[model samples]
Target chain A: MLTKRIIPCLDIDKGRVVKGVNFINIKDAGDPTELAEFYNSEVADELVFLDITATHEGRKTLIDVVKKVSSVVFIPLTVGGGIRTINDMRIMLEAGADKVSLNSSAIKNSAIITDCSKEFGAQCVVSAIDVKKEGDDWIVYTHGGRNKTNINALEWVKNVEELGAGEILLTSMDKDGSNNGYDNELLEKVNNIVNIPVIASGGAGSLKHLYEALKFGKADAILAASICHFGILSIKEVKNYLIKNKINIRL
Target chain B: MPDISILNTKSANFHSVKKAIDLYNKQNIITSDINEINNSKGLIIPGVSSTDTVMQNIKDLNLEKIILDFYSSGKPILCICVGMQILFENSEEGVKPGLGIIEGSVKKIPKLKNKFKVPHMGWNQLELVKESEIFKGISTNTNFYFVHSYFCDPLDEEIIIGKTNYSIQMCAAIQKNNLLAVQFHPEKSGKDGLKIYENFNKMIS
Candidate 1:
């Protein structure tokens, strides 16, 4: 049986990890390679590096970071942010990324998902959807959640899967960085519609929150940023909690 | 000196395999050169991409004959994911005939009442059915990373070594003489994954 994956998401800016990682072993918190090595040692099931700096130079820096991290870390590494073209996906995959997550770019051009999936296989393409709850419906947000599109989140997810996306990374913008919990309602709705694996992101405060996301939200994986970056919980600690709760997690 | 040669299929990810080999202080040469691959003691065909494109590239580069020659030579050859799929006769994912080195056809993982997802993504525990050198030092139920839509169904079940349950019990690893192939990607499977490479290295040595 496949185990639930616990992934640590690192926000990268100009090639450096942006968050203040409180791990004692890490000397340079800004260095993605160091944080990656630390997470690998801590038994993180997977690592995600999102380049918040969406620039040409920033993309180059992210590639260099990916190359360095891939050399040290053995587990799967997913690089996202600023990935607009098939060439961009190629650059990251060739640099050592197992998968590339498409957010704003995918929304702008749904055809890119099909093109990327054809070129690098659907398993290599991940459609990242940022959704915000509006009155009765979930609305899709783009450009780092600054601009809202009329696209309905539920409908978009189904379309993306048909477009050949292997997986969906659903983030609840309202719950993002709030540390309350994940939008299990939103997750449950999306997970029910898509056949591919759903990774629940945003609003992860404690281990219990992660567990709820997986157990209640029916998410195949949990992508946490603040909880891990601030050292509130280590990957092992989270895994242990999930295991004790009878959730099948990778240790 | 590198004892293992990883084929650069142009579609598959070779860096991960190289990194896995490097972790054990072993050297590996990534090349599509027929002579280099044939000369190596062991060869690994890493995973990723569709089988049609991979096979087309293999035939285009004329590596098919060399691969057959290597297989017939009885030297250890490890094929991963799509690499493993191409070892069979053919697949539903593509129209191209496989290497036909192994007697089986690649079939899509059956959907199980919405309980199982396609691509069989993420880490899953291995259920060892038969003993094989590739699984040495690895315990049963050890989790390994897997990302594939189709699974291999061998005509000769005797060659089956490992099985994993996603929605159904499918062949995870198969060994036929010196040719060993897995539906999972060990290079991305963490510590246990490295152990697989280490074990394969030991076999070659």
Candidate 2:
């Protein structure tokens, strides 16, 4: 049996780790390379470095940051943002990224997922979705949740899997930074519709939230930011809480 | 003639073997090329430093089909440490799809079971699970070096040829059809380990 993964997501802007309340009010957290090294020592099962500005900046892969983080951290590292082509995926993977997450890119060119998977394998590709409840329907958000796709969140996830995505990083834009908890309804819906592993991101306020995500949502992994970044909770604390709650985590 | 090939990427595992192979080539022991692979006999698949990057690196080098091709040709392939894991359908370390050439999943030795520090780094013993060509002439319970925490669990039990009880009855080696893989590092495992290599050499000879 596979142990459930606990991941810390580092939101990066101009190579610096930044955190915001609901994806705004950006504040510098620390040096990405330094923070990544810290998490690496904490036995973080995996790390995600999202270039929050890459989409707006029209950049390619986060080469320099990826190089710096990959050099120091031996654990699995994933990078997202501005990954538009197979070449971008190749660069990130060559730079030592274990996987590349596609958000806006997947919506723009679904074919990119298939092509990248063929070249780099499905496991190397991840589909990141920022979902927000739009009245009765759960709408999929793209370009960092600035625009809404007409597709339902569950259907969109299914489409990504069909395109050969190995995993789904589902984030609740509405519950993000609210410290409420994960969107169980949305997660359960997506989890049921998709067979691939779903990593619940966005609303992780407490260790209990993580437990709920794993237990109720059946999430294969959880991605947390503020609670972990501001030192309110450490990875060790989170893992300990999960263990006490009878949840499986890499000790 | 057997169609053999080397599978690895630019990871640390790939680096060491690449260095070793470079030394062999510099000494005129062998030539490095896929076509030459068929002439030379058995294949050499090196380990990945961690399970995380295996899929990308393997896909980056276009190794899966190449491996399946070798398997279909009935050539014996030796998977080193993590290389042995490529045989499984999946790994707990990553969400990547394994070759599934062997019917099983690769899982990390449960923390509840592991007494030794992970990465299992150093020489250990291989308690032969059963008698087979891979272990012929080698002592049944001879000690061979090991450095991995994850082991293969074949869906078909008959393929498991050897085991070592460290924290669990971990698989030391496997043989399914023409395919063979070992969780231990043969290149670093010293003489007894080399005997297993010698057996593989004799198979293709």
Best by lDDT: 1
TM-score: which candidate is best?
1
Off by over 4 Å in 2: A20-29, A55-61, B1-205
Q: Is model 2 an incorrect, acceptable, medium or high docking prediction?
A: incorrect
Question: How big is the positional error of residue B117 in model 2, measured in Å on the Cα after superposition?
Answer: 29
Backbone clash pairs for candidate 2 read: none
Lowest summed-lDDT stretch of 10 residues in model 1 chain A?
Answer: A16-25
Cα-based lDDT at residue B15, candidate 1? 82
A154-219 in candidate 2: lDDT tens per residue?
789889988878788999998898998999888888877876678898788888888999899888
Model 1 clashing residue pairs (backbone): none
- Segments in model 1 whose C-alpha atoms lie over 4 Å from true places: B25-27
TM-score of chain A of 2: 0.92
Name the 10 consecutive residues with the lowest summed lDDT in model 1 chain B: B19-28
What lDDT tens digits, residue by residue, belong to model 1 across residues A55-127? 9898888899999999888898998998989999998998999999999998889999999999999998999
